[model samples]
Target chain A: MTPNILEVQNLHFHYPDGSKALQGINMLINENSKVALLGPNGAGKSTLFLHLNALLKPCAGKIRYKGADFEYHKAFLKSLKKRVGIVFQNPDHQIFSASVKQDISFGLFNLGYSATEAGARVEEVGEKLNICELFDKPTHFLSVGQKKMVALAGVVVMQPEILICDEPNAGLDPGNYKILMNSLDTLYREGCTVIISTHDVDFAYSWADTIFILDQGRILKQGTFDQVFKDRRILEQAKLKPPWVFETWEKMIDNGMVSNILPAPRSQEQLYNMMSDRRIMKRTTPKIIEYQNV
Target chain B: MSPNVIRIDHYAYMSPLRNVHPGEKIFFSLSTMLLVLAMDSILISGIVLGVMSLIIVWRAGVKCGYFLKLLAIPLGFLLLGCLAVLFSVSSEGADYDYFIKVGAVFIGVSVDSFWNAVQLFTRSLAAVVCLYMLILTTPINHIICILQRLGVPAIIINLMVLIYNNIFLFVRSADEIYIAQVSRYGYHGWVGQIRSLSLLCSNLLVKSLKASNDAFNGMISRGFDGELKFVDEVFETKAGNIAATVILNCLLITIYLSGRV
Candidate 1:
């Protein structure tokens, strides 16, 4: 496995009102891997993420980024935030500039880049996100999806090592969702570990290679979907419904309709294609080629 | 609520003069406004009004009717002020062009006050349209960019940017709440409308406070370390914008100088 880029070890946090937000949480985020953190509201997802950036100090345990414990000092935090960019769930909150171009350049300017450098970086990210045309537009004039793109571009311009998106696709329409997913895909291709916290099981199943189930201030499970979802009890405890693709994949394996040893399908189309394969390997990895039933 | 409050800002994004440097627009509008005040000539003021109205409608591409409606907003106040200037009291009834029959006083317009009121009215209208010409053509963020470059204090600039960034958001939320209230007949009667408006105002204040806190968190997430740093907007100020400011002001000044105020 690749080296862990971020690790939370028995991290605990509580609000000032004494409400426990995170309780003895442990998790590891490997480098350059797509991770989907699934959780219900008030599950400490936001609190845990805040700890990752040292915005909120963990009450008991420590968070390590690139093997170094996150320091609460100013200098360390500035650098940590520079590397771990967070795309906020609400674009209105994230975007403070009236102009899209200026908003995208905000992070770069904070990092003390020269105006020339910041402008170039902003343009580069805008082009990558296909928001070049929107650069000149006012922030308030943009549609919700377009505003989300601007917010994403603002963080992407920082060129962070890890991009933690809080519900990035929450309010995106179908077209916008595809565009946003494509942008995330491009960022992943460029070696940014893209992590998104989402409630959509099917979306997480299809997209994230690593899945984490977070519940009641603790991480219930963390692994690939195949490893985590194979145990029905854990998912039930987390109150998360299994991704339909995972259910179908399991049913196909149990009925001998597909190779039990084969990998799980990520999408409906992939599952359908698997069912049409002429060669089927049984549970014992039988090397045989025959026309399978349609 | 006038929907135009939000529309006016949004329309600036569609402005044809957007590429023209905001500083130049600021320079042109302010200098011309000052010139109108200094010259106090009806011809120059009239020309400024006509030219600005044309530029806003023709050049900036704001709808003519909408601009006219916006232009009408100040007219009522102008009329009241003009009325105050147009009439005066004299117990001696000295050359009254028109007079009210009051027992011990004559209140009426003299030829001088008439000319004064006309110029005052025309000057005020001209100045307003000039500002509109600036506001409608240049986005507020660009103007804030100019202010930042002009050595404005960072705190004030930050506040301006924040207000510019979120004013429309609050406007939209208020509008949505108003719509939802109207749907439920919460604004059916006059009393109901008053109650609904007050509730909306209180609710908006609370919602805005929450939104602001969240916005601060968002800012913190993006490496905002207390200082509101932003890349200043850079524009390749075309010779055309400079020429327009210099030439148009020169023309207005020439018209002022060549005539008696």
Candidate 2:
């Protein structure tokens, strides 16, 4: 079994105004996997993300990192923060430097890297994100999409073991969305644990190996995509629509157009491939025609 | 006005002399400003202004019109201030060489006061020009780097960095709120305009506070302690440029002393 990189046990939290943000939450995030937290607005996704990065302390729970109880000491937090970086939803919130190069290098410098080392890391991340040309540009002068890239590059430069993003695709154009997804994919491929919170069901369905459905500060369901997304009760309770691939696959199966026992398709391409098998279509069309005639 | 400031900052980043060592630029500007302030001669002030203007426009590659526009901003304020030095009013009309008498009052510009006003105007203009040359050619981050090297206290430098970065954030936030209000016809009439403007200001204040909290959390998640460390591009000091800066300062001082004597 893969070791859990992070675990949360009965986490409870409240805002300073006494509003409950998280209530009795328990979760386990495995190492080297793409995890997606899916929920509607005000469903405590962002709160959970903050807890994971140790920005917020749970009032009545414990967090464990690498199978050990997490420590909240300053020195321990510094080490933990170095290993887990977060890219905020709003670029303006995370980017505190007018210079793009300086912003991207901020995390590296905080990690005690020499100036030369930090500069080299900044260059490498800039090249990876294709933002090298924007290094000298003022952060305010950039378009929203460019600012998002810079913010992501700022966290990516740290080379954290776990990279968590809050609403990574929010406000991005389609082209930028694809670029961000591909960048995250590359990071996942390179063995980083990439986690994202999003309301985009299709993106989560297609990308995440594991999905956690959060609703009202509680985990409605948590499992592999096939397990969590297959539960219609949880989806209805969370006010989330099933991914189109799953809906289409279910309709085809109910109509005897495809075998009911086949594995669920997680993407449009996968669904198309399932439907395009000539032998299955040939076998199912006769049964469909007979049923229609009856 | 805010947009114009942003434009100036953009030009600073793109200035041809952006890669020059910031220490050299800071030294040149400060020395020239000191000479203009110390010399107490209109001719020296004029020379310093001319030299700084030439550097900003021709050497730094800032547009001449844009530089003139920037200079015009302070010129208005300086003129208003120089008025106090230029004219005096007195009840008795005997002490002034030049006076306009109205009943028992005299209001005129004396020769001594006239010379002082001229000196003040030129001095202030020269100082403004020197500062502009520095700002137009060097990015604020580079200036911060120079300050850090010059042994400025870390707390002050950190505050400067935060304020410099957040000024843009503040402007952008305020702009967003203004646009949102405008779209909703929040500024339809006098009353609505006041209401909308007030709302925008209050919203900006709240948003800025929230943004600061978020920014601090983000900084902490990246291992930030008390101090802020930023990377700056390496710039080699040029011997020729330094030499030219020294020669120009010496010449300005020489001209100022000669005029004084």
Candidate 3:
């Protein structure tokens, strides 16, 4: 078995306002897993991410990182925060510095990098994120997409082990969404334990290795994409539909138009091939009076 | 943007005063004020103001008209105080020369006192300009770091942090309040305006208190100890920066001392 990088056992949390945000959540994220904490709105995904970085203290249970208990230890918590850098949903909340370069340096500077080193890191990450041109511009004046990229660079420059993104694609245009996904893929390939909380099921189905459906502060299901997508009932309860390809395949299955012996294709390309095979099969088979009704 | 409210946010680089240590700048302003209070002479204050104004324009890149506009606020208060000083004196042995008398009332003030007022005005203006230059260039976080380096009391430093946080909070709340009020025509008429402003202020105060508490909780959760740790990035005080600061300080002190001679 892979070494568990993060282990949350029976974790429970509630806000001061008495809202239960996380309830008895037991989760183990193995090292280098591109996991998707998939859920609809108010699904406690963000609350879970916050707990991972020790930003929110759980009322019960504990969180352990790499065999070190981090439940109440301040020093360990700070170390864990360094390891698990979270990108908040709204970029405006985190990008408080006057300039993009300064904003990118904020986290690294806090992490004890010398000015020259931090400047180099900021320049490197700024170039990678295409924010070099915005170095001298005031953060508030940047377009929302630019601000979001700058915020992401701020976290990336810190060089965290795990990257948790909360609803990164929510407000972005199509171009920005593609850019964000490619960045995540790059980070994932670099062996970063990536966790993304998103409402986009297709994105999760395409990119995530493991999917966990969170609802009402509890994990409803946890498994591979095929295992999670196979269960249609849980998807209905979580207010999530399967990816478009899955939905199309399911329709063909329900209509008695396709054999149950065929496997469910995971992606659009695979599904297109499956559909073409079915067409070939239909053309070879003689049409009966029942099939002729259509 | 209009000159008044828009002036609050610094626009350009304002690099000349950026490298000066906040503590040193604070001490310099306080010392200048002390000098003005000790010897309120027109010649001394005029020289200080003239020198400071020239430096502010030449080094700091502040426009002359803009600096004059900023000076107008204190100038108004000084005018009121000077008018009171002119009318209230009744001593027969007054050393100053009186210019005019309207029956029993003094119509025109003495030239010496007028010159003294000008001197006081210049000294105060110079000090205020220095402070403005300091804040405009230095980021707020850097200012906090400077204070921490200066060994400011933990409680006072914390208060400054709270003040900085609250300013952003209040700005956010004000924006929301304006949006909500404008939708209802609350800011339209004179009566609506008064009611809206009063309501907005009260709501803002309540929201600010709530936000402060939430922010405190967040800070505590994030291992924010009693003291805030400054980011370890070095602020290079290069040779040029030191030379500029030292030269400015020396010039101001020289002008202040020469007036006594």
- Tens digits of per-residue lDDT, candidate 1, A91-124, equal 7656655567866775565566788999889878
TM-score of chain B of 3: 0.71
Give lDDT for model 2: 0.82
At residue A222, candidate 3 shows an lDDT of 94
lDDT of 1 by residue, B9-94 (tens): 86787788997889889998999899988887899899999988999999998887888899789999999999999998888776
Compare the candidates by TM-score and give the number of the best one: 2
Which residue pairs overlap in candidate 2's backbone?
none
Per-residue lDDT over A213-275 for candidate 3, one digit per residue giving the tens place of the 0 to 100 score: 999999999988778987888898899988998778777777767754466677888887877
Across all models, the iRMS values in order are 17.3, 16.1, 16.6
Residue B201 alpha-carbon offset, candidate 2, angstroms: 20
Complex DockQ per candidate: 0.01, 0.01, 0.01
- Residue B78 lDDT (model 3): 73
The lDDT for every candidate, in the order shown, is: 0.81, 0.82, 0.71
TM-score per candidate, chains pooled: 0.52, 0.54, 0.52
Models ranked on lDDT: 2, 1, 3
C-alpha RMSD (angstroms) for model 1: 22.3
lDDT (tens digit, per residue) of candidate 2 on A1-294: 989998999999997436899999998889999999999899999888878777777889999989877786756766777778888787766665557886677556556678899999889998888999999898778988898999888888878889999999899999999999999999998999999999899999889989999999999998887788778998999999999888887888788786446788888888888778875543633334344553
Q: What is the DockQ of candidate 3?
A: 0.01
Recovered share of real interface contacts in candidate 3: 0.00
